[model samples]
Target: MEKREWKVCVTGGGSFIGSYLVNKLLQKGYIVHATLRSLKDAKTGILRGFPEAKEKLVLFEADLYSPHQFEAAIQGCDFVFHVATPLNHEPGSSQYKNTVEAALAGSKTIFMSCLRSGTVKRLIYTASVLSSSPLKEDGTAFKDFVDETCWTPLNDSLSYVYHDDHHKDYTYSKTLTEKEMLSYNNNENGCGGLEVVTIPCGLIGGDTIQSFASGSIAVCLSLITGNSETYKSLKFLESLLGKVPLVHIDDVCEAHIFCMENSSMKGRFLCASSYVSIAEIAGYYIQHYPEFNVKQEYVEGKKVDVKWGSTKLCEKGFVYKYDTKKILDDTIECARRIGYL
Candidate 1:
């Protein structure tokens, strides 16, 4: 049988992770179709990052809330990378609502459309460690290791007091979305014999901070960017110390590509190098860039304690070259490249 040209559609292609995925796919000679709110915005400046691959990057308007908008976006596409989601740490913010709703609605809509279109062969969903395992239940966060087997039961009795409706909603949405996808796997209405891969990654770190300064790694960059006073004053640094697992952006992107090529692989996977403490990362930045380092004393807050395991992905042959040390080194290089170091 002759190999078919992979036509991939990346949702939220204008955003940080999505754009990176688009670039990677385009470079590998795959025809990439990306969704944005508006091509006018993309034309204004979004393609600058991959100036050389501009021709390969096709932008379309496809809102997650609108199913009609997606027909053209996924037409003739063989793969789907659903990377778009609303982000807001503040529990009550509209951003959180939009993120939860969009992810749920948009994801399911795209999957169904792909099934109906009958062209897609595989669907790779970009999920976060947050969905697979959430720490909000214990009033504690994952300051350490987490894996695919872990599930954050927010509605459990343990969080009866603190689990607000919104928190429960977001968690429930993610859980159901993944569960529903699994349920749809072999059904006649679903992917139609298509394969699925869900990657649960931790604090996605990479060489690009300018695009997602408000995202997972941006907090780290903010702390080291002479803005430590705020993080310390709020004792946020304390909560962050020794908490949260870290993963490289490239690895996160690669795992999706790997899963796409490795058709036999199915189900959920947690992609991360290893666990590292915020304090350890802080110490590294302090040593390398004294100008950006702040006193440790100001980082006054309760110590963080959490552990998670990524052995599943590791055992599945997903070797993480960027361990904590390498991640920090690469982060610094990213800073230097962007002139933040």
Candidate 2:
């Protein structure tokens, strides 16, 4: 199909990844029905200013809780990029039960809307790599590597009892949401045509629209910012997954496009170009950005490497544009440019 003839719907169009995807789609000549919680957002302004956006892009107001609200956005679109996820981001905001309920319910509604949208041929979902690992039922680490086959165990033993409340919730959110989204493909009822492709990306950080300092970027820059709490979370994740799996936001956006354009792709594909330790990250900062006080303590020399970043996407011909150094460089540059540095 010609790119110009395709009407694509991108949920969470104002989000870190969604805005970039919106811009990429516009540049590629795809008519985008970009959905946000509100029409009058700062990100929407930037989106509207993109070249050809005036003619090719349309904005719609939608929220996860209301399934009907998504209908207008997905209405005649040939493809859907289901990126908007329910996340509090702030620490200690609510009870864990509420968080899980909201995540699963919102995710189900979005998937159901996509299935209900008869015109949608494919739905490219943004799954998180955090959804994997805690491999054993007894809360152990991954001995070999992580991949699409490795799902995070959520049955009370590990993930549910994780010490960090926020971490536990986020992991379960992605794991449960992914399982729910992919399960619809086997629907025996009248709703089974929507092809679902999940690109589970690790820590996403890179160029971002102004005023939108993403949580991923913040996590990546925790060492620089001296945010011990966020840095602790990263270390815990590293110990649990046994690797510093990460990828630039641009690569993530590119993967989304690649999954949508290529017809043969299916199931889940994990994305990450960098797998280094906190010491490795600190080393880079110490060399190039010595002016800032980079936390040297992260070089604890207790690193655990794992093979979580799957090469499945590359095997299917998708190439990455950024490495660990480049991912850090772009993330730092973008963060500085946006005054978040």
Each prediction's whole-model lDDT (CA) = 0.64, 0.80
What is candidate 2's CA lDDT for residue 141?
51
Error of 1 at 78 (Å): 1.3
Write candidate 2's Cα lDDT for 278-338 as tens digits.
Answer: 7888888888999887867766557665655477899999999899989999989988998
Candidate 2 lDDT (Cα, 0 to 1): 0.80
Top-lDDT structure, candidate number: 2
Worst 10 residues of 2 by lDDT: 89-98
Taking all chains together, the TM-score of candidate 2 against the true structure is 0.92
lDDT of 1 by residue, 1-341 (tens): 12337788888787767877777787788878888767777332655457545666677887665646877888888888877654433345443355556666667787877777788887777775556653445645553445666665545555432234544555566666676665566676545677777876666676662433425555556556646443432123223223556778888888888877765766888777766555566666667767765567424323555565557666767667677777767776776776555
TM-score of each: 0.79, 0.92
Model 2 misplaced regions, further than 4 Å:
89-97, 159-163
